[model samples]
Target: MVRRAKLVNDAVELVPVLQLFSTETYRRVYETLLSEWRTLEELKQLYGEGVEEALRILKNAGMLEIKWRMPSDPAGKPEKEYHVSYTHLSINVYISLKELNTILNAIFMAEDEESEIVDRILEQIGRGRISVQHISRETGLDNLFIRALAKKSLKLNLKGQLVEPAKNEEV
Candidate 1:
């Protein structure tokens, strides 16, 4: 019987990437790929089960590139080695207006201190203020957290000396 391919929508694509922040296993697998290429076997040895699905998700999101392929055993089945396509994958996320609204709404609804900081950072960036140093000083949040939240949750891209939201090409 032929297996149907899983349909990936915007939310589905975002889940794996978002999980990198909260899930230890996903974070470890992603960080490992950041340093060097690894085969499925090697990833399995290190991350055990769920590594395959996690790699598939990242590959679908355009974060990982196949480095090479070689036979895993005498049967000669090809095992592809993979590595991060960019040093910074978060910058590659394509956030639609809908996704951006959803992210912002979540931040607004959450009572956490970090959420408030992120909201302030977004408000500052949306107003044509793109400097991380400026946002950090204004929001009183750490520079690293502001940068990470902007790149990861808000899908901002660092171009030259400025960080801005990933342009919605569909617009």
Candidate 2:
């Protein structure tokens, strides 16, 4: 007896939710839940032990909704499935110059091979408001990846004449 979770809120707080899944396994479990509702057994099988605990934490935080299903067979037991409740997750991040530098520093800490493109994108965006096409042309990065990362990771406001960091988000 699976049912769609009610979308009571349009968005949820992302940072605290992110904090809940600090470990890689917990993150993987949460990502799996985002894709689709799954039974505890299914999650446990897919993610190994401690998945039940992770699901419980997410459910308690209102990030997941659980529906119980009573078995049709006389001797069978009840089962539960979990679904992500919110349509969006919002993070009110105040990215100061120091924080931005920290992010850049962390990116720089990665292997040079992997950080080259990321470094270029950050450098281009740091210059001023720019179009994804312009950034792509300048950075030699794929436009789609640049666009998505700018909007998602960098929190760019893409609706205006020029792409810019979202207003009220200090950089």
Candidate 3:
């Protein structure tokens, strides 16, 4: 088999691909196909019942393909052989910035106990402008993080070096 690469993005296909080596049977079946094409019965004889499952998973993930193999002699039964399609695999793990924000928002929603942390930070800010260091000392959040959360997240209205969260609470 030539070296072919498969790109797996969906979770359904990715699980089996990632487990190809660790799952034992999947690795065996894949290696078997890599060496040469084999019929279902040939695979069954070597790996037993698990061969079917491994083939199904590998086939669905674009790692294997089926081809018919005919007997050399007359009146002999033909067989369906499984061949490997790809010898290499590639995975995509990048998530869009919008998706990342959605996930972060879910974990930090101001509800019940989680709201206390938000309230604590909000309380540190007075109606008048205050320094990021003051908020960090009171809330235990880092100074740089405080500035980012203020301007980027809480939409704090900044006046030069200082910010007033009282104005952000309105938004």
| Best candidate, TM-score | 3
In the range 49-160, model 3's lDDT, one tens digit per residue, is 7787677656545577888899998799878898888888776656556644543443344446444644566676643327777777776765544543443323243344
Top lDDT model: 3
lDDT of 2 by residue, 1-171 (tens): 333443322112232254345567678877777778788788888889877657655653567777877889989997878866654544445545654443344333334544465556657778862777888788775554454333333234443224565454211
Model 3: colliding residue pairs: none
TM-score (C-alpha) between model 3 and the true structure: 0.51
lDDT by residue (36-100, candidate 1, tens digit) is 88888899899898786667546545576785576657788666788765453233456667656
Q: Cα lDDT of model 3 overall? A: 0.61
Model with the higher TM-score, candidate 2 or 3: 3
Off by over 4 Å in 3: 10-12, 96-171
Q: Please provide TM-scores, in order, for all candidate models, with all chains considered together.
A: 0.43, 0.42, 0.51
> Which stretches of candidate 1 lie above 4 Å from their native place?
1-16, 71-77, 89-101, 104-171
Candidate 2 is scored at a TM of 0.42
